[model samples]
Target: MDYRLEQDLLGDKNIEVSSYSGINTARALENFDLGGKTVNLHLIKEIALIKKAAAMTNKKLKFLQEDKADAIIKASEEVIDGKFDNEFKVSAFQGGAGTSTNMNVNEVIANRAIELLGGAKGEYDLVHPLNHVNMSQSTNDVYPSALRIAAIRLIRKLSTSLSSLQEALQIKENDFADIIKLGRTQLMDALPMTAGQGFGAYAKAIERDRWRIYKVEERLRQINLGGTAIGTGLNATNRYVFMMTDIIQDLTGLGIARSDYPMDITQNCDIFVETSGLLKSCSVNLLKISNDLRLLNSGPRGGFGEIILPKMQAGSTIMPGKVNPVIPEMVAQVSLRVISNDTAITMASSMGQLELNAFVPLIAECLLESLELLDRSVVLFKEKCIDDLLMDKDRCLENLENSLVSATALVPYIGYDKASLVSKKALSSGKTIREILLEEQILPIETIDKILSPNELIRTHISGK
Candidate 1:
């Protein structure tokens, strides 16, 4: 355990000689130890990108010497490549609006740059964290901009996963196109529908989610990267301020733009809230679809049992030969967790003060976690559950015939009053609607068969009379 002394405004502390983090990061490690949950690696990598862009911009502006800029650029690239990931030890729940995380990145980049420049790790004189690596940047601008970058990258991934999930549903929809089943509303029988129609509806909902997530990436593209401190580019030159976004865009290969009102972008965080709300909407659809699948796959013996999910694992400790709808259940839980993360993100976004939001780290944590969780869960759901789904055609027909739901189709010919009478009679006598209708001679056998035919009953479009 050899160490080197690193000094900050507070005092001096011994940093490990081999560590690539400086005094600020060391202080942050000691100050904010909330549950040992480190900042997201995506955020760290994006911030490193920002630092790299800033160094290049500074060198172009002649603010940093070429040698120092090159060292910092190389170090920042290493950080972006995750070579120094273990050095970012700050908590994700830290205060100062992610200043701790920002400084942690700065220190790691600076120390790594120092080592690259043939200087000792703690040699700030050669490559100072703030003066060299964080030139023309502040946590206020850098942190939020980096967060947007990380979030947009992750949002793209989520959109892709949603697309895959939608495709899986569409495949199932086609496979089950002719398998007629009972449609339930309010936990009661409603009408007859093909299992394909049900899966088609799920696919449509997920398609909307995919588009929503894809469109929201546009909102995140406008950033306030040069609005250092309080959206007033005080220490940063006008040239640097104007050039930052273009440099960052080129470096990260994202279609990012500078904010029209950097102050507004710096002060407000509602974009994140809006993004989280969209995620919650997607989660709502996922929860609904998962519940529907669970119901469709409910029981081979006792439940609706209209369809069977892939047998993932044993359902119970004591029940032999029992399998559970584990993938849908996992999808349901992930959706609920994403919903909860949305709530936290909403709260954290709304709690920002006049000029800066100190709660962005929490927002980043929850939002990134939600995105990753949904992406993985959706892929698992599609591969493990939706793709291998099996329909119990007999069970579907049995449930459809056992219920009085088909009485609604009788209304077109027999009128509503007659339909209700038929339903009531079928319920009371424990007979099916078709049986009761035929017994009472409500309609001719030819007409009755025409009305209750699966093709005639499940017609999605109406024919003009």
Candidate 2:
């Protein structure tokens, strides 16, 4: 393999002739090879966007020659289009507070721009990574700003997925509106409710999750993009500082703005912590709802046996003729992983020192993973599980009839003391509450029939005539 020699401050290194990345990226590959997880492509693309915006801003301010700025902009656009995805070779977990990753992007863009300008790949004389492509920016500002951009994009996708999931739940709620079942509290039968009502509760929970994700995305729009080094705009001009966010907002079509206090944005990572907490809240809802679906779909014969989940695959290797709620199980597992990622993000955000958070790479990895996981899992859950759910109306009615839960409906008519006695009699004799009420002539047969009716029992407001 023919190689080209490139040099950074550390020393000279040999880069492959065909590689777009230069010495800094080559060093990062060797130094931070701890994790096989590479930098997120989303973050890479957003960094490319920032590079393009910075180049345009420089050209506009007459700080860069038009020809050089055009080359950098073109290279950045190609990177944004993911044409050079393989060029970003640094590991996601690295020291230097994401400097390695940022420099990795800078090197790749600079080298590619060099190529576009009719120069060889390692020709820094034509397009130096730091002097040309990364002008007026520091890793401290660029890395976090790019992270926010990537996160905002992913948050929009996640919010859309949550909306779809909520819609699927709402559809199930409407479809199962007439199927009456026993509602349990603390694993014991408490009262009667339509299966639709149960699903409606799940729908409302997801609705809240969607709203939270949507609202919290606003926090990511304020960025410290021009706060070079330590948020003082030290090496960057005030004109460039004021113009960069607008250029980025125009390029990415997002509502991004410059931070009111760039130093605050640079010094504190609480916004990420808060955003991660919202993701955790969404994960909590997903975990609970997935478990609820699993419980409701537990058995063909041995469990709740009320609603049947879509059987995605064979349940066991040894047991024959068994199917499992694999979709909800998968959703549950994804939820668990997201919840765990939230913890990593929280710790990373809190571990930030005085000037900057050195843990932005970990936070980026975990937060992006959570966002992608939830987006994909929620879509899968809706299409594979919730949309195809089958309710056993007879099974629900049977469970409702066999349990003492329906006796609560009788309380409105027969009074609490009499309803308690009825429930006790039904439990002792192993007869249904309806059968006991009928046999004991606890009320006129016509009234007993009215009170025990599934539709009547599931009514929000039960009254005795």
What TM-score does prediction 2 earn? 0.96
Q: lDDT values of the candidates?
A: 0.89, 0.89
Per-candidate total of colliding backbone pairs: 0, 0
lDDT of 2 by residue, 1-465 (tens): 999987766778888999988787888888887767999999999999999999999999999989899999999999999999988878999988999888888888888888888999888989988998899999999998999999999999999999999999999999988777898999899888888999899999999999999999889999998898899888898899888988998998999999978988887888888888998899899899989888988878989888888878888999998998888889889889988988898899899999988998899999988889999999999999998988998888788777888788788777999999998998999988888888888788788777777677666677344
TM of each candidate vs. truth: 0.97, 0.96
Which regions of candidate 2 fall more than 4 Å away from where they truly are? 412-418
Output the worst ten-in-a-row residue range by lDDT, candidate 1: 456-465
Model 1 clash pairs?
A: none
